[model samples]
Target: MTPPSDPARIPGDAPDESELGRIAADLGLDIGAQHLAEYRLLIKQGLGGYSRLDELTSPPPTARHYDRDPGYLPGPDENPYHGWAWRCSIKGAPHGPLAGRRVAVKDNISVAGVPMLNGSPIMRGFIPHEDATVVTRLLNAGAEIVGKTAVPAFCADAAGLTGLEPQPSNPYDPTRLPGASSSGNAVVIVSGQADLAVGGDQGGSIRLPAAWSGCVGLKPTYGLVPYTGAFPLERTLDHVGPMAATVADCAAMLEVMAGADGLDPRQQLDLAIGSYTDMLEEDLRGLRVGVLREGFGIPGVSEPDVDAAVLAAAGTLARGGAEVMEVSVPLHSDGLSIWSAIVFQGATELVTRGDAIGANWNGHFDLDLVDFYRRAKPAHPAEFSPTVVFTVLFGTYLTEQCGHRYYVKAQNVARELGRQYAAALETVDVLLLPTAGMKATQRRTDGSIAQIVARALGNMHNTAPFDATGNPALSLPCGFSDGLPIGLMLVGRRYDDETVLRVGHAYEQLRGPLAVQPPKLADRR
Candidate 1:
């Protein structure tokens, strides 16, 4: 007789009960069996539902997490005063202007009283004495944080949800992955759990998730948002940006978070250039948007569905009187190494400095290190996988040795490309392109080399360069394929966010009212 089929198993489903228990144990949280079942169901629906930011719009039980505090509670309550844990003390005061606005903070960032794991088990019980500079800015501006969101085991995993990590379930399909290291934050906002979410992008962390989840994410030029009191990723390239249901929402969050903080010694020390929030509604009647079609048409990329979405969005811009032109970026496929180098350097620093930060990694990481290598690393060092030591470690050595030369070359190329694209933008309001060549990869049940690497490549294609260029980019849900949402990326020249945002706002409005709700789990309902 054939073996009985397992009801609990979904091909490539991640974090089984045993695995979930390990994560819970590592964090010292009590997760009930019922909660796990609910979470699993939520995960399954998320794969099919929330990724497009269509799910979770309507109230549902799967939206609540048993292991965490109440997230869906309605209120205009202002949250967080900056260093990590939320200062939910302002419940009944005059509703902050952003009172009704809901937000989710990337877990790696500081939120007072909230335990920021930094995606590492090492910082398990950490509670910052103060808020991150960005957090304080949010509260003062009246944005209410719905809750702290989850991240990959470390913020350095550039593959986003490429498949190897235990961190977050891509809301689109439980069978597939959500791009990470900023997993939870993106899922929540796109699922409509919040109106805005702030994500830190060092190597495409914010943009990857935004692309996968079909929302708007911005990686402000480095130093736009103060990093004071937040855990470090590479001190050099670390950036804090906004993740929201719309580009306008992200702009509002940026208004609060952008600025140098006296407390953070590493702050860029540059004067804040007025408010990013002020630019959200700027006119975009005539602007130039560049379409870098190079590498976009490569195999495993520019899938038919995404290509159509890109063209469709570009058409939308043309209809609005903006000019669109095709351009090329010296960004080769091998550019992942450039991103990997910066990312690995930061992870290595955090892993080494765990003790200094009073972090919580001992139990989870020591075990995970062995499991990660076994599950994902290629037998040959050249294979791609986000969690493999070979990937991260090798990147460290490359960056240490040849990083400067490559960075300079990359920057020069980027400058030339920017100048070229900027010229196009002189007439186009927003550049249009498939935010990523492929849809989010299917979730990895096994975390093998093949699964992980493929997903990472797909995750980084459209969003990474903007990080290096320090240009403002916007993503809007253009359409869907096989039920997964695809995004239209709008790249604007440095500090031209207002122009890009107005374009995004106008697009969002043209797309019509986008109100999507999470799939209902009858048991929870």
Candidate 2:
């Protein structure tokens, strides 16, 4: 499908510091301005923020759903981003139950008339003939798809620095990148642009963005939500999940997103989940919850706030009558590497699916994965960001060369990790851990290599293994650092989402609701 069309854009090549500063100023993004300056200095000093850059780019949205974001009025004069987006303020409107409940969707998933822009420009203009199984479920549940979110070309890197869709800037500090492919969705959710959003997770696509943006993200038991109609990242690992302001909200959305669908081969995965929303009230008491003390974690960045918040949240569960124990997974290193291979495997698939050159997809991005989608498309080699294109090109070769072997190894790692995780459940019905080591970072126009490692790897540090084990997992904001949300992951045994949901909801209520709101458009406010 063709990526959506939009008018905003950054030049194809990486912009200089001065240029980045100018862009930030125009948009009133202070954080971005600072990062651009710091980035310039670092480049001169031979330093790098590859991870930061990677986080900035990512699962480039298939189309810029919000680039030309439509404005709305609740009382004759209001901006969409300003008031209606805030959950607490608008939670009880005409949309009542979900009245005014605005949501954004990742382009990888089907949304009927909406196009699935999986980050490659090749599919431009290709709109889905029907709503993805998940979307139809959402409509029946009362939520609305306000816009489609951007991604990093494919569901490849969660940092979503794919630089497509005029990448959504972090609201708190525009300099920092909103962890993505579901980048904009998470940002809008946190910044009060949307109440909840539909996001897909292959590695950390959903959770990382949620953690980074201080929202709640969930990847239900694999088959709980059908994969039919959603673009593939890795058939085995891809999930259509929910991103929301709170755990209860996610549970509500999950209620509708899950059901049997004959069209999906994976539909065989639909187990009998009685009531996802009902599962929310399950007690945390007598729940065996585990804490990850060693191995399998986001590396490089040292985020004190993230660590402190996650620990505090875990302690909160203990205070709530749950027995939280410490645990570790086997072959953590091997497991992570194997997952990395999986990322390359899926991304290469998305990139190679087409032969088109640069073409516009979302509101602000024209992603062409044939070469490199980040940055503006260069007329030739000189215009390309060497590292970005090289990563994709080399990744294509690597997936082709080592993917099968890695797949076997990853399967083993999945087995080993699952066994250990399952054993941990003996003492704790659920396991808790930091979703990512840090909050969101600055978004950049440069190819963000480290962001990939931080996001894809950091998130999977505690996640992926579950995908391997076919178990269920959930992430909720336990607390915040500097007001930005941090996630507390709840991992459960295979097909045990019910237990996880109960514990998650109990803990989420204790944490209360998020209190952030988007700014009223200048004069309107």
Candidate 3:
């Protein structure tokens, strides 16, 4: 990289005295007119370097490394469940671990020439010029790019509701919602549209959908997989990982996707990627499973059938030679509150103020996406969904009224939460819990604002906390309730994703296949 030119002794892009006074008033500063002139001159002097920056050329965009066509959006006939955002075939390497396997890339993830809506009309015509790191890695491992799965607008809702047409529905029951914002990733997997998928999770997006749709989804240990080109919600909570029809496929995909890509700041410098597939055959002979007691019996959230199913699944794990014991971490119940405080303020700072690409971080930044988002959001404000609108409003209010105190406090609390969970994990290999307190919820198009909000965020209690702690959490199909699939979640120590997968695989072997079948696409049509 070349250094920028030296600053010239010329005033450039500095605010005038009047503008500076207004800015100071907006920020609640008490600078007098006497000091305003001095501040203006000093500001102009400080801004002189930016003139050189403006004259210098920017670095070129990442070059496209593979051949691909601009994929077309699928019509109703082809997308009965509204799972696909765009469809195309981009073949990968001739042979590798995932050769011939079709994989779905979530729309929030960039795929070079593919049009990524991200379930929001605000970004309707934008096309990514570079593939996300996960996309490139998957293609390198011989997994053919099949399609981009749909998500809730800006991936803000977990109920699969979007501002655009054809909202995603549960594969088991069309009238119900498939969990989101990895809604379509789960849909395509259960419908057999793809063999594997890459799902982004901030707060239970991957695991919630997998639970409702009967697929295996793993939110790998935070930073275990790079998030270079994905649309992020909150940086601290953002995670990209694998989802598949089975644990083996999920593990195989993780083997390819996990590893620092040098472009993501979220990954630690000393991080070591595990061989997830190699540990799948490991038995559960001495694995101690702690059934998190607080993960069950929420006042309004937990359903009897869902809890019963998860407990039964634990019993099955015990039958397979694993020690199952109930453990309580009182702080576990407060995970969602801590997550909200951080996300609300953090997202507003990064997305609303920072143009979705915050500063003060050293890593690859997609300037093209940032430029587009900056231009598009202001022009098409109404295109934002209710969920997104609420997030912005709430987050902005929090920041404006409270400053960073709440966010700072929440982060401090989150560290303690991680310590408590780590202490509990010291005696056990993994913590077992229900992925969500309930099963798939019924789709409601007409409801009060409170009802809609409740539907979108109500089921995230069990899954959100792990995101805060950066624990490797996996959701796998465990049982069925009233013909709907129930999910059992396994959480392991940080960077211990392989053990989580191994335990999930062991449980899969112990329990026979789920009895309910995926609804036929033709029947829906």
> Against the true structure, whose TM-score is highest?
3
Residues 1-525, candidate 2: write the lDDT tens digits: 223334234333455888767777876677655578676665555423443454475453323221222322133243332212211111112333454566667767665455555554544555554556666655545556665666665555656555344555665566666676676677667666567788887766777777776677887777677776576656567677888877778877777677767655555643686576776776677677778765324556447777777878878788888887777655544555666665554445543333322123221222322223222233223322222354467666765666556656666667776677777777778777777666766554444655444443444565665555656777777766675666777777776777877888898777666555434233232
| Residue 383 displacement in candidate 3 (angstroms) | 2.3
What is the full ranking by lDDT, best candidate first? 3, 2, 1
- Where in model 1 is the C-alpha error above 4 Å? 1-95, 159-167, 263-283, 330-337, 345-388, 399-429, 453-458, 514-525
Count clashes in each candidate, considering only residues at least 3 apart in sequence or on different chains. 46, 56, 0
Segments in model 3 whose C-alpha atoms lie over 4 Å from true places: 1-13, 520-525
Question: How much RMSD separates candidate 2 from the native structure?
Answer: 15.4
Model 1 C-alpha lDDT per residue in residues 1-525, reported as the tens digit of each score: 111222122344545777777787876789987688677766766665335543334332111111223233122222111111222322212355466576678777765555555654344444443466677667666666556666655565654542223445556665656667666667666555566777887667777777776677877766667766555555555678888777677777776677776545445566546565565455445566667666367565678888887787767766776666776555444444555544454455443323223243221112222222223223323333356354456555755676556545655665555566566556655566766777777765366755555555446766766665566777667877876777677777666666667777777766665444334222110
lDDT of each: 0.58, 0.60, 0.88
Could you tell me the lDDT of residue 476 within candidate 2?
74
The number of the candidate with the highest lDDT is 3
Best first by TM-score, ranked:
3, 2, 1
Evaluated against the true structure, the overall lDDT of model 3 is 0.88
Model 3, 435-508: lDDT tens digits are 99999988975766667777887788999899999999999999898888899999999999989999999999
